[model samples]
Target: MLKVQEIRELIKLVDQSSISEFVYEIDDAKIKLKKNTTVTTVEAKPAVQQVVVEEVAKPKAVEVQAVKQETKVEAVKEEVKKDETIDTSDLHKVTSPMVGTFYQAPSPDSDPYVQVGSKVSNETIVCIVEAMKLFNEIEAEVNGEIVEILVKDGQLVEYGQPLFLVKPE
Candidate 1:
C-alpha cells in the first residue's frame, strides 16, 4: 500500500506529464496513473515474503536434516569413487571456529557429531569442540554435503583447523 504522500506525488506526476500513462515504484508498492482516462484501476497485492527471515528453531531443523545427510553422502561417495580427487580437492571446507578438543559426539557413548555425506546448513551442529570444559557446539556455516571428516574423534584441535570438507549445494 502506498502512503498519502505517495498518492499525492502520483497525482502531481500525472498533472505535469504530457504522456497518457506514468508508473512509479517505491519499496513494495507500485503506483500507476493515467491522464484523460475515466476508468481507474485499484489493485491490492497480497502480502510479500520477507527477505530477512527469523528462524526460531534452526538448530533442531539442522539436527533433523542430519538424518538424511547419509544418503546424500552415499551419492557423493559413488561420484568420489569415480574420481577420488573430486571429493577433497575442489570441495569447500568447514574449519573449527575456535581452539578446543574436538569431539565427534556429545558423549563417548553417543554417535559422533556428523559423518561423511552429511548434508548441513548454517544452523546445523556439525560437532562439539570442548574448550576449558565448555562444550561448544560447532555449526555448519555453509549449506553443503560433508565429503570428509578431517580430524579424528576425541582429537585435540586448534583454532581454525579443517574439520569437514563440504560441497556447496
Candidate 2:
C-alpha cells in the first residue's frame, strides 16, 4: 500500500505532466491517478478493491467511475462522432491555461467579465480560474466579439479546455 505522502507526491507529479491519466500495478495492488479541473484524485488499492481520494478545490465532491471494457469501446465511438460534428476553423477559442475552477465573475455578486456580444481585445481578462487557492485572470488573446461562454460559473475546467468562442474582428 502506498502512503499518504506518496500519493500526494504522485498527484503533484501527474498534475505537472501532460498525461491526463496514470495507472500503475505492483503485485496485487493498483494505483490510478486522474486529473480534472476542480479536483485531483488518486485511487490506490488491492486489485480486487477500490479506493478513491479526491482533493476538490471547491466545497463540492465529484465522483468518477471506471467503465467496463465494452462501454469504453462504445464511448470512444461516440466521442469520435461528436468530435467530427464540431467546426472551429474560423472561431477563436479562449482556452484555460491551467486546470481549475472556472469563475465567470471576480466575485459572486459582481458582473461577469464578458458575455455574448461583448467586444474584447487581446488583453481583456475574460474570466478567472482558481487553482490551488490562486485565482488566475484569463485573457482574451484574440481581438473579437464574444460568441459563447462554454463553461458555467464554478465549473471545473481542464487545462486547454475552451472557455469561450469568439468571432474575430
Candidate 3:
C-alpha cells in the first residue's frame, strides 16, 4: 500500500509541474497520480516547509472512520438510486469520449449534468470528465430521453464506456 505521504508527494509533483498525470509500478506498489485542478493552491502552499511540518497528524482511528463512512454513504446512495434504474428494455447507449474520472456534476455540491428521465437534445451536456486537469464536457450524441445512467458518478470510465442509455423520441 502507498503511504499517505507518498500519495501527497505524487499529487504535489503533478500540481507543481505541467505534467498532467504520472503512473508507475515498482514491485508490488503501483502509483497513479492525476492532477486535480481544484487542488492547485493547496499543493503550492508549502514548498519551503518540509511536508512533515505542515501536515496535520491525524489518528488512524479518525482516518479509517472517515474513509469507511464516506464509502458507506456512497454505497447507500447508490442503492437508493438503483431503485430508479431503468429497465434498459429499449435505450440507446451514449459512450464516453475519453478515458478519465466521470463526474455527473460540475462539482461535488452541485446538481448533476443529467438525471434519469431527463430530456436532452443533441447539444446537451451529458457529463463532464476531468482528465489531466481539464474538464471536458461531453455532449449527448443522440436526441432522446435519458432512460438510464450506465455509470455512477465519480466512477473511473474507460474510452467508449457507455454513460447514458437513452430512449429516442
Candidate 4:
C-alpha cells in the first residue's frame, strides 16, 4: 500500500509531466491518474482503501465526500470569480507550493499568523501547510496587507492554489 506522501508525490510528478495518464500497481493496491482538457482525476484502490482527487475547470457548487473502508476523497479546485465587485487587478495572490492541509495557526489554541488587514512583509510566515506530518511555514513573499483569505483554517489546499490575496505596500 502506498503512503499518502507517496501519493502526493505521484500527483505532483504527473501534473508536471506531459503524460496524460499513469498507472501503478503493487500487490493489492492499484493507482490510476488521468488528465483531460477540463479535469484531472486520480484513483487509488488498495485493498479496502481508496483515494481520489478531482479538479474541474468550471465554477459550480463544490461537493466533497469521504467514505470509510473503501474510501473516496474528492477535491474540487474552485475558480476565482472575476466578475466580483472588488478590483483584484492590483492584488497579489499567495499560492500553496504543494498539496497539503492548510493551517492558519501554529496550534489549535493559537491565533492565526495573519488575518485580513494584517500588514506583512516578504518574510512573514502567513500560514503552515502540513504534508505527511511535516509542517511547512508558508511566507507572504510580498510586502502587503492581507486583503482576504481564500481557504478555511483546516482546508486541504492544492499545489499552486491561491491561499490569500494581498494589497501590496
Give the Å shift of residue 92 in candidate 4.
0.7
The candidate that wins on TM-score is 4
Candidate 2 lDDT by residue in tens digits, 65-162: 33455678899999998887546689999999999999999999999999999999999999999999999999999999998888999999999999
Give the per-residue lDDT of model 1 (tens digit) for 35-149. Answer: 8889645445556776887878556877778867987999889998888555466777788888888888888899876799888897889999988989999888889888888
lDDT of 4 by residue, 1-169 (tens): 7898999899889889999989888887778888665655555563575779798676444332223312322211122344444677999999999999999999999999999999999999999999999999999999999999999999999999999999999
Query: TM-scores of the models, in the given order?
Result: 0.48, 0.51, 0.49, 0.52
What lDDT does each candidate get?
Answer: 0.81, 0.87, 0.82, 0.86
- Candidate 3 residue spans exceeding 4 A from truth: 1-90
Ten residues in sequence with the least summed lDDT for candidate 1: 39-48
Instruction: Tell me which residue pairs clash in candidate 4.
Output: none
Q: Which ranges in model 2 have alpha carbons more than 4 Å from their true place?
A: 1-87
Give the Å shift of residue 68 in candidate 4.
36
lDDT measured at residue 30 in model 2 versus the true structure, 0 to 100:
72
Clash pairs detected, candidate 2: none
Model 4 spans with C-alpha error above 4 angstroms: 1-85
lDDT of 2: 0.87
lDDT of 3 by residue, 1-169 (tens): 5577977887777778998877766555666666654433222222255455577777799899999999999999999899876777777888888999999998999999899889999899989988888999999887999977878888999998888898988
Cα displacement (angstroms), candidate 1, residue 140, comes to 0.9
